[model samples]
Target: MPRFGEDYHHFHSQPEPSAAYSTSLSSWAPSEQQRSLPPPRWSSSASWFVPPTRLLALLLLLTVALQPALARALDEEGEGSGDGGKGGDFSVDMYHIPKPFQFVETPRDMQVIEERAASFFCHTSDAAEVSVQWRKNGQAILPSSTTASAEDVPGGSVLTILPKMKDNNATFECVAENALGDTISAQASLTVYEDNANAIPEGFPQFRLAEMEEEEPDKFPVFWPLAIEVEPDVLEVNCEATGDPEPKIKWFKSMRPLELKNPRYSVLAPGRLQIKISREEDDGTLYSCMAVNEKGVVFSGVFGLYHLE
Candidate 1:
């Protein structure tokens, strides 16, 4: 043991080991063949002894076993010593991505026609493959002669339909969708106008005149082939309304509703109600006119009839 300790010192301090020392150690060392032989069995009395290397290895293993538990204990104690709110605080861990999609309602300015029609404009940040369909009373529109089809629009899509072609009053809808999600617009009513040519002002567009004939006449249908002539100073007004359920017309002269009994006025037809007011009196004035059925109302463009005379 003394010799081995002295040799370890010389290995670090001396310049180098001579080849003679190597030769002497090689001659004294056991050969690989001899070392491979089984170690001699230890007696019961010798079993108590442990090699220094084995003792050191055991000590290291024991230290490793205690370290993790000690670390956990220190962590627990530190956490208990501070604010409870800070103890459990952690960053938000998002688990899953959510779908993105939204909807915009159809413009109220749209005139409801014979066929049901509403449009939903979809807005979304994500690009997606989308499909939109309209359903009424929870029934899908199928391939049919009168059934309206779904059309694609920018950033989304729209579905149009004639919910019930036979009945002038069917509910309509607009639906928009994309791969991420779907959105729906509220129900709307359709107005199927039947043409009563006599009821249309004679000068009104030919297409609109045809609409009056579509429905059975409720009252003596009247038509105005020639809209009454008006001077530049006069404000001329005419109105026509249609609906599954018949629509009514209300006229306002300036801010007040007008009575047709005046000698200056004549009611030629039910729908072709006309009004003439001198521009010298009514210029720069705003008038409100509305057409209404059970389902809804449509207001007309503001009319200004006169300038400062």
Candidate 2:
């Protein structure tokens, strides 16, 4: 009911709010019980909202939990691929291993004419990686005389020699070697004969001896004992003799004179005979040599030639 002027003056005269009163009215002034209570929960619609850091932490936990399962799945897929996932173009053959050298064909004993070329042949398996060496009389021969053919597969090696009489009975062997081991071939021998001993005599003509002043006792030709069993690729026999005059010799097979014109048969001076290639027909055949001169005639012991098993 006061006048307007008086009411305005009274409102201006009222005191301003003090710091203590403001503190008492502030919403931050909470009691002990309210402080002990949990914070207020958000509304249901807003409950799904989460801080970025919390979301990231949950994702990391999920990843760690699934790691073992992912690894197992990858391992299973690799096994199903059939190569165990070794990958990157690497390969291995577990079943096969390198092998040692082995002989296929061994050299054979041979007889060659004097001053002629002699050849020997030998073969081995796994030739590509093998190295061949020729040995004679237990000494290594030079490689210049050796020739190898068919390098990529099992093949043969040839040894050629221009032989002399000194080479008679020379033993030769072939050695093939690889990373694994060496293979030694059986021994082979060379028998060399003089060309003059292989030459054929001309015609055998009858001759008369001139009378001498002093009469001498006639010395007939004689032969030593011959081998009972002879087996060789080439048949060779010598009919040695002792006589007053040099004796002329003739060879016979099975009681018949050998075909002198046949290329396989060779007759040399005094009495060496050779059959180039002995055949099955030559088996069990008897061979003999006859010697005749002005004084007398003689027959050598019979010999039977056979083939080796």
Candidate 3:
């Protein structure tokens, strides 16, 4: 038999064994086969080893097997390390959250005369450690002559205003702030009325008196006087006058000032004086209406009442 060489077997096909020898191949000695057969050779290049498709399949299976474990590890890191997650170190409890600011008492609208003092009040609930501030028309209010100051009270703050003409019809509000956030109260209105009486001329009772009338008369006499006829009943007279600095009116009976506190006597709108007189002594009583301003005082002519009984 030809000696089997590594290159010979690699290049050519081996001869077929005879039937009689093939049936008795197991009877051959292992030492004789080991001495006779040349050492088997393996390809040094990797290209002859495994198919590309099978290698790719194996890598894909390995990746699929490890996917769940990788995802679990990432989830644990996110939960335990960073902020804002439920299991995070910096997570905040829902029950222990800081309370948001709320208004307990809001400021109310008010009116004041010029140069008068007014105060606005604002309170908040759960205001501990929170800061309160005052604002006017969305701007912060500062201490000045017009705005006196703001002070803290028991549960809130009070803003004092020395009202001036420029502050008329201004809106004010209160703001409270804390770590959580800030809240604003409803706006309060401030109305300042003008004080024209302060600028009156330097003269006592420097005013003019116009002709008085009780009822319409068809003719005007040189000396027209106001007269009225009434039974023992209620009497009302309206005395309308206009003067600088807005005049104030008063009524007198027999040169005596009328007592305003008496319920029987009333002063009505447009300077009308009403008296409940149901006595004989009130007949022919001299009644006069007087208007006074900062400048001076003026009186209406005495009106005589004739009793018709």
Q: What residue runs in model 1 are displaced by over 4 Å at the alpha carbon? A: 1-100, 107-127, 160-165, 182-185, 197-309
Note the clash tally of each candidate. 19, 0, 4
- Residues 76-158 of candidate 1 have per-residue lDDT tens digits of 76688787435544356778876456554452322333332223233333356656565554566664736665555445444
lDDT of 3: 0.61
* Model 3 lDDT tens row, 235-270: 677676666667777676654555578886778765
Clashing pairs in 3: 205-295, 205-296, 205-297, 206-296
lDDT score for residue 252 of model 2: 66
lDDT of model 2 at residue 243? 51
Span of ten consecutive residues with least summed lDDT in model 3: 216-225
Cα TM-score of candidate 1? 0.29
Candidate 1: minimum summed lDDT over ten consecutive residues — where? 202-211
Worst 10 residues of 2 by lDDT: 203-212
Model 3 RMSD vs true structure: 24.6
Candidate 2 residues 1-309, lDDT tens each? 344445445555545544423354454454454345444434424545678899999999999999788777767777777876543233456987765556777777765545444456577766575667778998888645432111212354666566778887999887777656655566688776554422312321112221222332232212343542235465567775545567677676654556678987767555667676556677788877665554434455567777767
Candidate 3 Cα outliers beyond 4 Å, as residue runs: 1-100, 144-146, 196-309
For each candidate, give its TM-score against the true structure.
Answer: 0.29, 0.32, 0.32
